[model samples]
Target: MRDFIGRAMMTLYFTVCATLKSGAMIVALRDPTWSWARGISVAADVAALGFLVLIVATTVARLPPVKTAQGIEPRLSALIGCFATVTLIAVPGVQTLPQLELVADLITIVGFTLCIWCLWWLGRSFSITAQARRLVTAGPYQLVRHPLYACEAVVLFGIVLRNPTWAVVAIGAIVICFQCRRIINEEKVLRSAFPEYDAYARATPILIPSISTLRELVFPGAR
Candidate 1:
């Protein structure tokens, strides 16, 4: 069937991507040039690798969606946003202050860890395209509607910081634009599929969490 083929292809795509990236990172970590910066970078790579493996696993195990966007645009947006940052790997690293690179590595490590947490909550609902599998409103989703994408944005920003080049910045900006489009398309699909999604969106911020939102999440009685 066509649907079965699509799912198989998707699984293959994610599997190849995760395997290659993880292998490269593992090899890099094995290099004998150990330093504080390298250690931090290794941590970031490990977190990133974990996230990638999770993505492949979730993609293979995710539930069937109730509704899927019915256009080429949504698929294109999702694919672009998902893979855009990969170009940064080819960009030459710039010579920067060791402290600055270390800060960027720390930021990526934190972002990737949060991303993994978000993905854990997403679980069976994960999809590369705009599709509504189930209404997830727990964990990081309680604070922000698209916490996964927000965390990914953090990782992308950290990568840009690590490789401060005009091409990197331009690609980052383009990727962000596509990511925004992907978010919009996903919201539309979710709202169409779930009647309660509108109310949830109203209560939760889209990407950024405010101070009041943090307080409410911490102390539910405050609301």
Candidate 2:
């Protein structure tokens, strides 16, 4: 019953997210100026909508987890980390655009695209919070243990660039800290569920790949 409720809530959440992104895309497309920024915003919205819909579908079809993170702490950390950056919405918009606005938009586009790509690989294993749905060690997982979070960090950095305020920076730091905690909690859950997880973790970088890791990715034969 709890799983059913959680799944329903997650599905509803992603559905709403997709709907909002769709609306944003339409509004951006209909802009009278139709500037480069407008085009980039529309692109980002489209990418966001793509992943959001995928998330909704996957959440509904996801298999039951072998183990879920116990305790309210893990759940709270994940929830806070996921939604903490929403405070940026309350920050006053700056009229004078920073030189990095375009770059930020471009980063957001790439981030959203990468996120969708990762989500495609994640499929039914996707979950907003920490749970060992399945031991996915393929695709982007081959590069990093938490590719989705890495992609999200990229998107979050872009958001900070778009805002470029001290307040936003502070919020970003807070979000990062919470996200790290969430990762820790997730790692514990995964380790508890899968015996091979420890070996995978030892082999894979936690988030950012090391130089050696990148070299290996580019040259699979390199030892």
Specify the highest-TM-score model's number. Answer: 1
Q: What's the lDDT of the predicted structure labeled candidate 2?
A: 0.79
The reply for model 1, stretches above 4 Å from the true place, is 86-95, 219-223
lDDT of 1: 0.84
How many steric clashes between backbone atoms does each model show? 0, 0
Q: What is the C-alpha lDDT profile of model 2 across 1-223, one tens digit per residue?
A: 8888988987876676667667667666777886777677566666667767777888899988889988998888887776664334223234447457778778878987898888889988887678888999999898999998899889788878877788788889988998899899899999999999999999999998888878987998898
User: What TM-score does each of the candidates earn?
Assistant: 0.91, 0.89
Error of 1 at 188 (Å): 0.8
User: How do the residues 13-53 of candidate 1 rate in per-residue lDDT, one tens digit apiece?
Assistant: 66676676677677777798889888887787777778877
Candidate 2, residue 12: Cα displacement in angstroms equals 1.3
Q: RMSD of candidate 1 to the true fold? A: 2.1
TM-score of candidate 1 on Cα atoms, chains taken together:
0.91
Tell me the deviation in Å of residue 1 in model 1: 4.0
Q: lDDT for every model?
A: 0.84, 0.79
